[model samples]
Target chain A: MNDLPHGLLTPQILVELDVLERNIERVARTVSAKGLALRPHAKTHKMHEIAGRQLEAGAVGLTVATIGEALTFALHGVGDLFVAYPLWISDAQAKRIRELLSYVKLSLGTDSIAAVQQLARQLADKKDKLGLMIEIDSGHHRSGVLPDEALDVARAAREAGLNVIGIFTFPGHSYAPGKPQEVTDQEQHALGEAARLLRADGFELKRISGGSTPTAELADNSLLTEVRPGVYVFGDAQQFELGRCQWENIALSVASTVISRHEGDAQNPRRIVLDAGSKILGSDRPGWATGFGRILENPDARISAISEHHATVLWPEGQPLPAYGEQLRVIPNHVCVAVNLVDQVSVVRDGEVIEHWDVAARGLNF
Target chain B: MNDLPHGLLTPQILVELDVLERNIERVARTVSAKGLALRPHAKTHKMHEIAGRQLEAGAVGLTVATIGEALTFALHGVGDLFVAYPLWISDAQAKRIRELLSYVKLSLGTDSIAAVQQLARQLADKKDKLGLMIEIDSGHHRSGVLPDEALDVARAAREAGLNVIGIFTFPGHSYAPGKPQEVTDQEQHALGEAARLLRADGFELKRISGGSTPTAELADNSLLTEVRPGVYVFGDAQQFELGRCQWENIALSVASTVISRHEGDAQNPRRIVLDAGSKILGSDRPGWATGFGRILENPDARISAISEHHATVLWPEGQPLPAYGEQLRVIPNHVCVAVNLVDQVSVVRDGEVIEHWDVAARGLNF
Candidate 1:
């Protein structure tokens, strides 16, 4: 991979392999010491190489959002896989799921009784055991049934001969700055209530999974059996902005060159144009984000706009801006999505190039 | 490629060889009838297999946006390539450019004399053989020199001993609905003026190119030497909404399943959820776009919101909503970005599965 030559890195993401391993170890140790099962979400680093590393770091298993991701990790030799998203299984997808279940210990999520019933009908005669988790909506309204609705889903799964494993909730609202503690508490409350409801319905709740990166540190492990933190392994602009991580903790960045420069009007004095744009960094600026993303070398230079080929940055005063052809690294706002935008990432170790890892499972958004 | 088990097409994009060939033939024949040299941009369909077919369909050459893309194409034996973006070359990039120049005819675009000067310094010895195209800013204010400034850059390339081939511009404004004719007219005017300016500078302009899929149908071949249209080969939601293509012309789609349904309050009755969301269908909704993208089978269902894994669709009143586990095909707003978001596309031919072609260049965004 290193023989390909230098400039071959275009719209390329550079991940310091050593730093990534450090971050993974830090999170795993924290969760393991807290007596919580660590299941790093594979969505952040979709590559099998990273997944293998996480498993070696003492993670019990891996968490994925899509059936496609579950299949990818399973093929890569990951034994225990938790598909955290509430997935609807069509006839075609059911067949694929059954095949995946035979190869790995699979745990699926469902928020509704109908969904649980549908899954049960499909898995009735299958020899492989399928574990079903009742999804409870902690705070994020995207998916999951309310804590009160968990019993019905768990009952439905049990009736279908599917094992009613436990409950899981994604405290996505924890990503907002200063809200991690509150969201984590809410998550615990929701999961505890769901567990009680499932027990009352005569189902054994073996696990109560919760905690994203932002809330992992604040999770009350007494109520939860496991935690899933994806982006902690590769801190991004969002984590930095939320004060969840330090700059040195950031493991991935887009190494781009200053392609052009535009001295704006007196109102906007300093501006530099980068070869990295939305196509490279991804046009994903959350409403709360300060800019498109963050510049690693020049934090003062804010990304003002993003065209397909150029990233327009508004440089801060008193800072000498990057000249044309100068290289700079940028940490994207959302690292997982940014990683998905490229084919491979250069693994750098202590300023020297180590290897290039193919994002084998990239673009598997299905 | 087709020897895998009946349902082994897990995460890889399965391309029906016959469907892709038909799509390529249709677009090639359409442009051929118009007497325009068809040079499909490799940015959309990055697979070399598809590009080879385009070349076989009488496409003169391939158009790429990045040097990395050109290198990938060149590695796959595509000789004639046009790097369409204004590339800023550093010492590191210059070395790669030199290597590429050794194998293929490389035509690069530049909008500034300073950029041209840098290219000249890099290609000092091989200037006589290298190709340079001056870019004109036709309405999109993103990049490119003004038509009036094209001569200065062309003269700079000539002084640098590089061949001033022609001029090109991206009529990005053509993406707006109902503006294709106007954008095409503006593009032609800019190209014609730039050509005249270069000719006045005593430089022979061999290629005058401009045409996005939206403007291709309205482009006047009498004034240009070639036209580069990328998205026409596989029509997308943007094309369908802009009146550039019909429902039958959309050859690409995300086959997603309905995961949930919400029977809303009396004021808002029906809403269905799909597995596809921004992660699958890109969140590229121009202000004028109807929604994030469009549902191919259910035009009445409007995609109201897209969370990470859930796409909420508001069904029209009295319409039969898709039941849980029902599959729906979604045509994304921008085909290029959407295709780049996934590792594979299921190529369907006459409703029969065929070969699973890997998107080898899936994430070459850089």
Candidate 2:
């Protein structure tokens, strides 16, 4: 552990190479054994190194949330990409998309006719070569058209000369505690119905993409051809609380130094201030997300409160508090946002830093 | 407004150059009128252009939260800087600080005897030349020693051959709704007591720094020799709701395109989704904060829900909803987090793109 970055900086993202590789192997094995294509979402780690590892582990393609993300992976030589977003592309972006298409096979998600038609117009001359998926609204009522309405978008894209690649849905509701099984059932039903409806509409629904790290394992291989999971490679506090992964399975953790130790009062005796705060750990506490995050050194020590540059962890009654300047590994509430907050992450193996990787796709929301 | 970036990616940060100038001028004028030295916090905009403007407007120096942030500004010719947070400096960072001090009049924050002694040892030969400020716990209760305990840390620094330059604090509690006045009063008391204690202890304390955007206006120039305010330069939803500023004062907003819309099923009557999600707008909602943020086009519309890549906003019944692909300006709950999420911001004047300013000090947490 002494090999870990010390006296360098506080609140720096540190990915254990051995653990990260194990996480990638574990997910790839499960995905491959189930005979389903693994399109690991690059939006989690957002590093070319991690994306390359996934590709090496037999991922058919990489999944992204934005054109910028897709562009980053494509530029880094990740050939096949899926922009799993109902994008509102500008003319300039459409041109950029074409530029990306010239280098790799690109797939896009469409939930509305306007988006399908717009994409068709953008892909005009080469529309027939482009891949499109009709995104179906599963239990997660964020985006995507309803299952019954998937055919309208599929047919519209086909009419516009784009290849309609079946349907896809994100069972994001699975994030809540113990809701994975229930949300997975909802996802299976939604995608199954959308594929059936598209087939009945005289369309050959070839591909069905089911996404959501929490619901990925419960995905039926027969109904869902592929599963796109981003956070599985990270395993955050939310995932740990959801029983989706164990603490030992969390591959991503932040190295933070204890900056101040305030023995509050008799009522609250063990409160220590950490350098990791909202700016680094990220302010992503869902009502159910125990605390800001769990202190890996002592899970019972919860980050009771957080400000922009300080995290106050109050240890339950009798546990020993870390001394000022002591380092602690913190598992953030949501690894994705926390990863996005840093410019680069130090890759370590058995306490020794192997190398540093740039969070290439970070802040690439555009 | 038509000349503004259109058909571009959604969830991009847009800064109205005219409004930005007005905000800077407003804060500089306020601080100047009070005869207090203004050292605008660069952690807000984190851009060289804005820092330059503040310096041009008579700002004595720049205040940064991290050594990296200070270094960036210093490399850009920003000579005088202060790292206001209680930093945990490592051996490597101590070396970096020396490099910074070579070009800039740098000041470091210390709240513990250990930190002061460590810093003194690191700067052993020229320890007395290094500027150090004992951070006093005004009312935030995050970091800093109590006013009464400041002497112990001060004597430790002086004994270690270091110069103790007065004290500093952040009235962070003022961030709560309707608590600005009370927090400001607390700050005055804390700083006033610390100064008196230090003077009686036979210490010549000169630089008494104070910070807090919400409480900056209420700061007493007689006690606080310098004031640092960051978020005031770009008002946010929190500020607007706290009556600190008005809607017209919000200089920064996310230009997000309407991605999805749900026409009620009796539950949610007029709900629409924007591409700007937590990854773009940032998740920093205080309990009293109305919503994630407010839509500038429709202030009544509240982003009641948000995911990583989508913000679900519900408008008041019967209010017009933006069409899919239409753009809306969103004022984030906290502008600092939102600005930190993006790499570059679109600078517009008269609704036309003038230049792009890199969030230069972004992700410089270390």
Clash count in backbone of candidate 1: 6
Tell how far residue A196 is off in model 2, in angstroms: 2.3
How do the residues A237-308 of candidate 1 rate in per-residue lDDT, one tens digit apiece?
999999999888989888887765545445334577777876667766666888888888877778867766
Query: What tens digits encode model 2's per-residue C-alpha lDDT throughout B213-310?
Result: 88898887878889999998889999999989888888889998888787757533468889999998889888998899988888788888888899
Chain A agreement with the truth for model 2, given as TM-score: 0.97
Q: Could you report the DockQ of all the candidates, in the order they appear?
A: 0.31, 0.66
Q: Residue A314 lDDT in model 2?
A: 82
> What is the per-residue lDDT of model 2 for residues A265-308, given as tens digits with 9 covering 90 to 100?
75334588888888888899989878899988887888878887
Q: Per-residue CA lDDT of candidate 1, range B69-128, in tens?
A: 888899889999999987777766788888888889889888777788888887788787
Q: What DockQ would you assign to candidate 1?
A: 0.31
